[model samples]
Target chain A: MSPVLRAFLIISALLLLAPLLFPSVYYYRIGVLVLINTLSVTGMVVLLGYVGLVSLGHAGFFAIGAYATAVLPAYGIPPILTILVGAIGAALVAAFIGKPILRLKGHYLAIATLGFGMLVWMVLSKEAWLTGGPDGMVVESIDVKAPFELLGIKIKTAIAWYWICAVAVVIGIVLATNLANSPAGRAMRAVHESDVAAASLGIDVARTKLTAFIISAVYASVAGSLLALFNRYVTPDTADFLHSIEIMTMTVLGGASSVYGALIGALILTSLPQMLTVFAEYENMMFGAIMILTMVLMRQGLAPAIAQLFSRGRK
Target chain B: MSEFVQFCFSGLTVGAIYASVALGFTLIYNASGVINFSQGEFVVIGGMTTAVLIASGVPIWLAAPIAIIAAVIAGMTLYKLAIEPARGAPLVTLIIITIGASIFLRGLMQTVFDKQIHRYEGFSGEQSIAIFGAALLPQSIWILGGSLVVFVLLVWFLSRTKAGNAIRATSSDILAAKLAGINTNSTMMLAFALSAATGALAGVLATPVTFTSYDAGVLMALKGFAAMMLGGVGSPAGALIGGILIGLIEAFTAGYISSDYKDAAAFLVIFLVLFFMPGGLFGMVRVERV
Candidate 1:
C-alpha cells in the first residue's frame, strides 16, 4: 500500500477505536474539538508548511464560517447549506484580500493580515443588528442522526458530533495529502524556497499562493461552522487576535511541515487544558514558555524533532 | 467648530501617546531588524509600576523614575533571554519569540499585580482647561508636552551622543560597524533599553487619562504599529507624523462616523495607503539584491 493510504488507515483505526476509552460525554466533546482543530491545522500545514506563507488572519475566516451558520439559518437558509456558504464566502474574501496583502513580505505581511483580522473582529462585535453584537447568537444544529436512525443505530449528540467531525477530518486529511503530492504542491514548495526562483522556473507564484490562501480559509471556515453547530452558539471571540495566535501556535508547535504533526498539535492543545485545570492561572506563562522553547530549541517542531531523535537512536 | 477643536485636542493627546510608542518601535527596528512585539508590554510595565507605587503612598516624583527603570530592565531581560538566543533567526521565528515574551510579561504582571484597571491622579491635577467650548484635561497637555520632550531628547541623543552614533552605525551596516570596533550586541541591548524607556514614559503620562490594565498593551502595540506603518517603517519623523495622523483620523471617525468603527477606519486607511505607496509616506523603497 502507498504511504498515504497506510497513514490514512492508521489514523482511521485510531479514530474508530479511541472512543472505547471515553468514560463520559465530556471527553467526546473534547474529541470533537480536537477533530475540528485538526481539520483547521491541516490547512495551516498546507499554507505555512508547504507554501511558507504566514497568515495571522485565518480566524477571520473561521468567524465568517461561524457567523454564517448562526445568522444564515434565520434567513430561511438550510443548516447544511450554511457551511458551504461560509466556506465559499471565506474563500472569496481570502482571494480578494490575498492578492494585494500577499505582495508584502515578512513583518509587513504579518501586520497586514493582522489588520484584516482585526477589521473582521471589530465588525462582528459592533454590528449588533446583524451579528447580535458581542453577546453572540445561537447556531442552528444540523440533523446528523437521521441517516443513522435508518440503520437502527442511535447515538448521543456529542458522540454524533464526534463521528461526523471524524469523518470530515479523515476526508480533509486525504484531500490535503493528495494536494501535498500534486504538481501544484511542488509549485508551492518551490515558491516557499524562493518565489523569484519559482517565478523564473515558469511557475505562477501569485496564483499558487492565492490557491493556498483560499484553501486554508475554506478549511478554517468549515471547522468554525462545525464548532458552531456542535456548540449551538457562536461569538466574535472566535475571530479575535488571540484565537489567531492560538491557531498559529498550534501549527508551529505540532510541526508545520507534517500532516500528522498538525494532528498531534491539535490533540495536545485541545486536550491539555482539560487535564491541566489546576494550572489554569499559569496557562499563559506556560504557553509563552512553550512557544519560546519550541522556536529556540527545536525550530522544526515536535514531531520532526522526535522523528530525528528516533532515527538517531536506531543508527 | 468648537466640536472640531475638541476632537482635535483629544486627537493630539492620544496621538502623542501613539507617537512615543511608535518611536519605541523605530529604535528597535533600526538597531535590529526585528519588530519588537513586546513594545507595548513595556508601556504596561511603566504604567502598572507607577500606579502600584503611587497607591502604596509613594510620591509621583519617586514612582515615575522607578517605573521607567523597571521597564528598562524588563526590556534588557527580554533581549538577553529570548532575542539573543535566537540571533539570526528568521523573521517568523523572531516574531514568535517576541510575542512569547509579551505573553510571558503579561502573565507575570497579572500574577504580580491584580487584573484590575489602574490609574493615579494626573500630575497637574484634574482641572479641565476650556478651549473653544471644549473641556480639555490638564493631563492631556502633560502627555503632549512629555512626548515632545522625549522626541527632542531622542533626536539630540541620536545625532550628538557617542553611544547613539554607535547604534546608528551598527543599524546602517553591522559588518562595517564591527570592523570599526563598534559592539553590535551592546548596541542592540541599548536600543531595547531606550525603546522600553520611551514606551514606559508614554504609559506613565497617558495612564491618568487612559487608565491601563495588564491587557492594555496589545491594543497599544497594534495602534502603534499602525502608526509606524502609516508614517514609514524606519523613519523617526515618519513615526511622529504617522501616529498623529492615525489619532486624528480615529478621533474624526469616532466623531463623524460610527464610534464603533473608529479602529476599522484607521486600518482601512492603512490598507489604502499601502496599496498606493508600498513603502509608506517617508520610507525608502527597498531593492532586493537577489
Candidate 2:
C-alpha cells in the first residue's frame, strides 16, 4: 500500500483499538483532544516542518476559526457551515498577512507572527460585544445523535466526538501526506532548503510560501472549530501567546519532518500533563528543558530520535 | 497642558526602563545572535531578590547591588547551560531554546518566590517634585539618571575599551574575530553578563513603580523586543530611541484613546515599521548569502 493509504490504515486501527483497550469515557474525551491537537499539528508541519518557516502566532488563526463558529450562528448561518466559513476566513487572512510577513527571514518572521497573534488576542479579549470579552462565549454544541440514530447505533457524546475527531485527523493526515508527495510539496521542500536557490530554479518562492501558510491556517482554523464545538465554549485564551507556543512546541517536539511524528507529538504533550500531575508546577520549566534538550540532543524530535535508536539497535 | 506634561514624564520614565531592557536585548543579539527571551526574567530576578532582601532587613544600598549581581549570575548561567550547549542551532531552534529558558526561569521563580507581587522602596523617597506643573516622583528622577549613566558608560565601554572592541569584532564576524585571536567565548560571556546587568537594573528601578511578579517577564520581554525592533535590531542608539518612542506612543494612546488598547499601539507600530521599513529606523538592511 502507498504511504498515504498505510497512514490512513494505521490511524483507523488506532482509533478502533484504543476505545476497546481503555473502555473509559474519560479516555475518549482525552482522545478527542489529542485528535484535535493532532489535526492542528498536522497543519503546523506544513509550514514549520516542511517549508522551514516559523510562526509564533498560529493561535490567531485557530481563534478565528473558533470565533467564527461562535459568532456566525447568530446571523442565521447554521453551526456546521461555520466550519467552512472559519477555514475560508482564516485562509483569506493568512494570504493577506502572509504577503509582507513571509518576505522577511527567520527571526523577523517570528516577531511579525508574534505581533499578529498579540493583535488577535487583544481584539478577542477587548471586543466584549463581539467575543463576549474575557469571560468567553458559549458555542452551540455539535449534535451527532441524528446520524448515529439513523444508523441504529447509540453512542455517548464523548465517544461520538472521539470518532468525529479521529475521522478529522485521518482526513487531515491523508491530505497532508498527499500534499507532501505532490509537485507543490517538492517546491516547498526546495524553498525550505534555500528560497534563493528555489527561485533561481524557476520556483515562485513567495507564492509557494504563501500557499503553505494559507493551507496551514485552514488546518488550524478547522481544528479550532472542532475544539469549540466539542467544548461548547470559546475564549480569547484560544489565541493567547501561550497556546500558540504550545502548538509550536508540539510541532517541533513531534518531529517537524514527518506527519506521524506530529501526531505522536500532539498525543504525548496533551497526555503528558494528565499523567504527571505531581509535576504540574514544573510544567513550564519542563517544557523549556525538554525543548532545549530536544534541540541539543535530538534535533529531529522524539519520533525521529526513537526511530534512529531503533534502527541503530537493529543494525 | 499639565496633562500632556504628566504623560510625557510618565512616558519618559517608562521609556527609560524599556530602553534599558532593549539595550539588554541588543547586547545579547549582537554578540551571540540569540534574542535572549529570558532577558526580562533577569529584571524580575533582580527586583524580586531585592524585595526579598530588603524585607529580610538588608540595607537598601547593599540589597540593590546584590540583586543586580544575582541577575548577572542568572544571565551567565542561562548562556552557559542552555545557549552555549546548543551553539550553531538554527535561528528558530535558538529562539525556542531561549523561550524555553524563559519559561523554565519563570517556573523556577514561581516555585521559589510564590506568585505574589513584590517591590521595594525606590532609591529615593516617594516625594513628588513639580516640573512644568506636573508632579514627578523622585524615583522617576533616579530612573532617568540611572538609565542615562548606564547608556553613557556602555557607549564608552563599547568605543574605548579593548574588550568592547572584541565584542564589536565578534558581532561583526565571529570567525574573523577568532582568527584575529580574540577570545570570542569571553566576549560572548561579557555580552550576556552586560545584558543581564542592564535588564536587572531596569527591573530594580521600575519595580518600585510597576511592581514585580514571576509572570511579569514575558510582557517586559515582548515590550523590549518590540522596542528593539522599532529602533533597529542591533543598534544601541536604536534600542534607546525605539524604546522611548514606544513609551511615548503608548502614553499618548492611553491619554487620548482607550487605555485598554495601549499595548496594542506598540505592536501596531512594530507591524507598520516591519512592513514599511524592515531595516527599522537605524538598522541597515541585512543581505543573506545563499
Candidate 3:
C-alpha cells in the first residue's frame, strides 16, 4: 500500500484499540491532552517544517483561542462557536502582525515572535476582570457532553471528550498530511530552503509565508479550543511564556518535520510530567535534565533520529 | 509630582540593574555568537548565594565576594562542560543548550536554596534619601553609578588593554585572531566568565532593592534580552544606552499607563524596533542570502 493508505490503516487500528489500552478513565483524559498537543504540533510542522519561519508567539494564538472559550460564553455566545471565533481571531491577529514581523529573518524574527508572545501573556495576566488574573477563571462546561449521552450508555465525560479530541486530531492529521504533499507545501519548502530561490521561481514568497502562518494559527486555535473544552477551566498560565516554550520543546523533541513526529513528541511530553509527579519534588529537575539530554543527543529530533539509526542498521 | 520623580528614580535604578545584565549578554554574544539565555540564572545565583550566606551570619563583605567567586566558577564550568561539547552545533542547538543550562540551574537553586524569596540590608542601609522631594535609596545610586562605571571601564578596556584587543579581534574574526596567535578557545571561556560575573554582580547589587528568589531568572533574562536587542546585540555602547532607555520606558509606562501593561509596553517597543530597525539601534544590517 501507498504511504498515505498505510498511515490511515494504522490510525484506524489505533482508534479502534484505544479503549483496550486505557486501564481507567483518567488515561482517556491524558489521551485527550495528547491529541490536543498533537494538533498544535501539526500546526508547527506547517510553519517550521514547511515555511521555514519560526514563531515563538504561536502560543499567543493558542492563548487567544483558550481565553475566548473561557470568556465568550459569559457574553451569551454558544460554546461551540467559541472554537470558530478563536480560530478567526487568531488568524486575523497573525495576518496583522505578520505584515511587519515577517520581514525580519533569523534571530530578529525569533525575538519579534517572542515579543508577541510576551505581550499576550501580559494581557492575560493583567486583565483580571476578564481573565481572572493569574489565579485563572472557571469556564462553563462546553456542554458537548449533552449530545454524547443520547448514544445510550453514558460514558465518562473524559472519555467523551477524548473521542471528540481524537476525531479532531484525525481530521487535523489528514489535513496537514494533505497540505504537506500539496503544491503549497512544495512552495513553502522552496521558501524555507532559500527564499531568494523561491522568489526566483516566481513564488509569492510573502503571501505563501502568510498563508502558512495563518493556517498554523488555525491549528493552534483548534487545539486551544479543545483544551479549554476538556479542562472546563482556563488560566493565564496556559498561554504563558513557559507554556510557549513547552510547545516548542515538544516540537523540537518529536521532530519538526513530520506530524506524526510531533504527535509522538507531544505524547511523551504530556505523559512525562504526570509520570514524574510520582517522584515529587524532583519533577522539575528531571524535566530540565530530560529536555537538555534530548536536544543534545537527539538534535535531529527524536523521531527522525531514531528512524535514521534504524535505517542505518537495516542497511 | 513627587511620586512621579520617585517612580522615575526607581525605574532608572532597576533599569541600571537590567543594563548590567544586558551588558553581560552582549559580552557573551560578541565572543561566542550565542544569546546565552542562562545569563539570568547567573544573576539569581549571585543573589541567592549571598542572601543564604548572610542568613547564615556571614559578614556582608565576605559573603558578597564569595557569592561572586562561586558564580564565576559555575559559569566557567558551564562553558567547559556543556558549551565546549557542542562547539560545532547549529545555532538552535546552542540556544537550547543555554536554555537547558538555565532550567537546570533554576531547578538546582530551588532544591538547594528552597523556594522562599529573600532580601538583605542594602550596603548603605534601607534608608531612602530625598531627591527632588522623592526618596531615593542609596543603594540605587550605588547600582546606577556602578553600571555606568563598568560600561566606561569596559570601553576603555576593549580599546586600550592588550587582552581586550585580543577579545575584540576574536569577536570580529575568530579565525583571523586564531591565526594571529590568540587562543580563541581561552578567549571564549574568559568571555563567558566575565559575562557571568557581571550578571552575578548585578544580582548582588540589586537584590536588596528588588529582592531575589528562585523564580526571578525568567523576568531578569527577558528584560536583559530586550535591552540587548534594543541596544543592538553586539554593541557595548548600545547596551548602555539601550539599557537606560528601556529602564526609563518601564518607569514612565508604569507611572502613566496601567501597571499591568508596563511589561507589554516594553515588548511593543521591541516589536516595533524589530520591524523598523532589524539591525537594532546601533547595529548595521548584515546582508545574508535567504
Per-model lDDT: 0.88, 0.87, 0.82
Candidate 1's displacement at residue A221, Å, is: 0.8
Report the C-alpha lDDT of model 2 over B221-248, residue by residue, as the tens digit: 7788889889999999999988888888
| Candidate 2: tens digits of C-alpha lDDT, residues A192-245 | 888899999999999999999999999999999999999999999999877887
lDDT of 1 at A271: 87
Tens-digit per-residue lDDT, A1-315, candidate 1: 865786689679989998999999989999999999998888888888888877777789899999999999899999889999999999999998888877777676677777788899998998999999999988876888877788999998889889999999988888888888889999999998888999999999889988998999999999999999988998899998777777777888998887887788888877898788844667667667777888888887887987788899999
Off by over 4 Å in 2: A309-315
Winner of 2 and 3 under DockQ: 2
Q: Model 1's CAPRI class? A: medium
Say which prediction, candidate 1 or candidate 3, comes out ahead on lDDT.
1
Judging by lDDT against the true structure, name the best candidate: 1
Off by over 4 Å in 3: A1-6, A145-154, A278-280, A309-315
| lDDT (Cα, tens digit) per residue for candidate 3, span A1-315 | 755555566665776687798888888888888889988888988887777666767788888899898899999988889999999999999899887777665455556676788788788888898899888888778566767877765777888888888788878877887788888988998988787899999999888888998999889888988888878888877776666666777777888777767778888888877666653466455555655776667766777877788899999
Task: Count clashing residue pairs per candidate.
Answer: 0, 0, 0
Query: How accurately is candidate 1 docked according to DockQ?
Result: 0.63
What is candidate 2's local distance difference test score? 0.87
List pairs with backbone clashes in candidate 1: none
- Which model is ahead, 2 or 3, in terms of TM-score? 2
The weakest ten consecutive residues by lDDT in model 1 chain B span: B265-274
Arrange candidates, best lDDT first. 1, 2, 3
